[model samples]
Target chain A: MKLTCTVNGLRIEATAEPRLLLVDFLRHQLRLTATHVGCEIGVCGACTVIVDDEPVRSCLMLAVQADGCRIETAESLAAGGELSPMQASLHAHHGLQCGFCTPGILMTLEALARSGQLPGDEDGVRHVLGGHVCRCTGYQHIVDAVLAQAR
Target chain B: MKPPSFAYARPGTVAEAAGLLAQGDGAVLLAGGQSLMPMLNLRLAAPDTVIDINGIAGLADVRRDDGRLRIGAMARQAALMRTPAVGEALPLLALALPHIGHPQTRSRGTIGGSLCHADPAAELALVAVAADAVLTLLSSAGTRTVPARAFFLHAMETVRAADEILTEITFPASRPGARCAFRELARRHGDFAIAAVAAEWSPEGLTIAVGGLEATPRVCAHLSRELAGRPFEQAAVVRLIDEELAQTEPLEDGVIGPDYRLQLARVLLNDCLAEVLPP
Candidate 1:
């Protein structure tokens, strides 16, 4: 099956099997390896991406389902050579250690921030970012980073 | 995990989608595909064809008319949660929406998909039962509305025929004095609930629906009847929990034991009732 969708800012078309996950198509077919796949069952938030301005689990969505949708991955967050606010926050606060979960976290937070309803306080940031799990950072710095960004 | 080889059809209209479903013996509707994707990948479901309903027109609108909230089958959970009418008119649903999955899953997960998937522990199932939401199922023959009470027969079992596509879900506007709360116990923040309860309190009576603890969402009308005129105290709440557990069987799997789930049900029920009930 040939699937065409707007990825990042570019419209791309590729032939894929009906069973291919959007995450695989994005990483393997499109070579956008920044969108990592973890906990393929959708439990881990490591496969998050923005589809139609809303964050979703790319691993849990088929490539065909995204045939006409706009997809933004972690790579899209950083344009030109500068990092997105989420990436900058994660870096400044050392919110990532292994960095495997960073992309998913950034995508999820990016969606929240894009909604323009993100809180402007520490507790508010904690509540907003509480949905994503991080094995590293003890979550304090991640929380701190979100809080810093909120301010 | 890749899904089994299957033909995929992206129909532009519900009539086309319904026709596709009627043609294939084991055709399944693909909406958000949050649950279906995992099931397909695991090979738990191997339908010969998948009728992609995302392209279907007029299935993604959320509208309110004639005192009822009508949500299209394709309306995403995130979209539903953000709709002011849903938050204002169907507070229970709005409250349960955030608990379905994380924001990412909710972004694409649809209300109709959740109800049709009929997970015994799904928050939407409990909310549907508690709110007495009506499901609109469509087939080539026509359309019919099934009350939530009769829609779910067992765990992951719905009354929807293989050829029927769930079109919409409608619920009466929440009463002015109605208060609802949802409580669940999960291994982690986003894990499936071990046991959960959705409670709605009205001056007429209370409606408590327990999910994840039974084969299907169980509505304890007896408890609601008994709780009438009685204060929702610790003892009264415990009695209701005891009666609910006594009437329904908890789902037992590798994750949690039945006894543990029964106990958690009691704790969650009490907590939920305490929040909704006056002191």
Candidate 2:
């Protein structure tokens, strides 16, 4: 099957197996490894990505399903070699320990912020952040970072 | 893990999709792919063919007709919260939407998919049963509507035929002054509930469905009769759950035991009833 989509403002097409997952296609074919795959099932949001401006579990979507959609990953956050606000906030708030879950959380919050759906308060941020699992930083700093940006 | 290689077809119409499904062996309908894709990747389901129904037009519409809230099969879970029609017509569903998975998963999960997947712990199926929703099933032969109570046969099981497609579900609009509430217990926010309760109190009566404690959403007729036309009493609800759950024969569901399941069910039921009761 031929998979085609705009990733981070670039339109690209590649041949992939019908069973190829969007996460694998992004990581392997596109060489965009920032989007991590955790818990191959849909439970973990580690494979989260923005498809058509909404966050979705890339691991649970096929490359074919994304054929005409506009997708944005964590790589799209940085601008001209500068850290995006979300990245900078994560840094200032100490949001990452091992950082395996950082990219997915960034993409999830990126969509929330882009769509003007970012929560305005701590509880709201934590509720939205609850979608993505973070094994490190106890989610306090992550919540702090998101709340910082959410403000 | 990679899903087993399978043939895929995107049919442009419901008739085409139904024909494809009927002709192919182990063919499964794919809507939002939120549930089906995960099952496929886990190798828990290896259908010979996947018939993507996203291309089928008119299946995603949510309309209100003659006091019934009609939700097309492809109606996404997120839309229940975001769409004005769904938000106003189906407030119960709107209340339950955020609890489905997460905002992201809800963006791609559909009503038909969730009901067809029929997880006993899932919120949508329980809401459907609580509302006594009616489902419209279509196949190459014809169409039929089944009550939500009869549609769900067991966990991950339904009365829907292999060749039939669930096209829509309809819930009668709530009566004036009716109130509904949903409560569940899970390790995390987005995880599946260990035990859950969805309840609605109205002129019709107190309709309730308890999930994650049985193969399908369990409705206590005796309790509903006792609950109608009266203020909620926590002790009575707890006693009813105690007497009923003792004979439930809970399955060994990996994490919790039968006793714990009953306890959680009681707690959730009490919590939900308290929320929906008159102030």
Candidate 3:
């Protein structure tokens, strides 16, 4: 199947298998590997990405289904070789250790911030972070990083 | 794991989708893909044909129609939270929506997809039963409306025919002064409820529905009627609910026991009823 979508302001036109997940297409076809695939199921948010301004599980969506949609991945965060504010905050706060779950969290927060839905407090940030699973850092630093950007 | 390769059809119309469903040996409708995609990746479902209905028009509408809150089957859970009509007319459903899944899943999970999935612990299906919502199903032959209670046959099973598509669900507008409450207990936030209860109080009567303890949510009809317009007696209502729950065999899985589910049901029902009923 032909998959066409705008990724990080770049028009991507490629042929992919009908069953190819959007996460796979973004990583393999586009070679934009920031989006990590943790659990192939939607349980893990490591495959999160922005589709048409809303954060969605890339693993849960087929590349064909994303045709013509505007997709934003973690690769879009640091375009000018400089850390984006969220990335900077995460780094300053030591939000990530193993970094397997960082890309999805960053993309999730990116969509929330873009939509003006970022929570202002720690509890609210933690609530949104519930969707993500991180074995390292115990989410304390992640909450700090998100709270820093949220305010 | 990845989904098995299969023929994919993005139908432009419900009729076309229904035709694909009717013709294909193993055709499945793809709505939000929040649930279906996971099942497919896990190889739990292997449809020969995947009918992508996301391209169909007018399937995501949420509006008030003829004094009823008519929600299209493809209405995303996150979108429903933003919809004024849903919050204004169906507060119970609005309250339960947050518990369906995380905001990430809710962004793409459709109410119709959840109902069609027919998970016993699904918050939307529990609210559907509690509100007595009417579901409209479409097929190549015609359309039919079934009450939510009758739509769910068992866990992950429904009366919907293979060729039928659930198009919309119509919930009667809440009456003035109607009070409703929803409560669910899950291991974690956004997890499937171990036991959940939805209760509504109105001048006409009372409706209470409990889920996660059985293959389908159990509507406490007689108990609801008995307690209508009466001051809530905690002990008496608890006893009544206990008696009612005793009749239906509770579902027991490896993690949770049947007795624990029944206990959770009792507590949740009491908690929700206390909020809506007169003290």
DockQ each: 0.65, 0.83, 0.89
The residue-by-residue lDDT of candidate 3 on B10-68, one tens digit each, is 99999999988889468999999988999999999999999999999999999888779
Q: Ten consecutive residues with minimal summed lDDT in candidate 1 chain B?
A: B228-237
Q: Could you estimate the TM-score for every candidate?
A: 0.95, 0.96, 0.98
Expressed as tens digits, the lDDT of each residue in A68-107 for candidate 1 is 8999999988899899887898899888999888888888
Name the fnat for model 1. 0.64
**Model 2: pairs clashing at backbone N, Cα or C within 3 Å:** none
Ranking by lDDT: 3, 2, 1
Q: Which lDDT tens digits does candidate 1 get at residues B179-201?
A: 88888878766578888888888
Model 3, residue B75: distance off in Å is 0.5
Residue ranges of candidate 1 with Cα displaced over 4 Å: A121-131
Better of 1 and 3 by DockQ: 3
- Docking quality tier of model 3: high
RMSD of 2: 1.6
Clashing residue pairs, backbone N/CA/C < 3 A, model 3: none
Instruction: Write the number of the candidate with greater DockQ, choosing between 1 and 2.
Output: 2
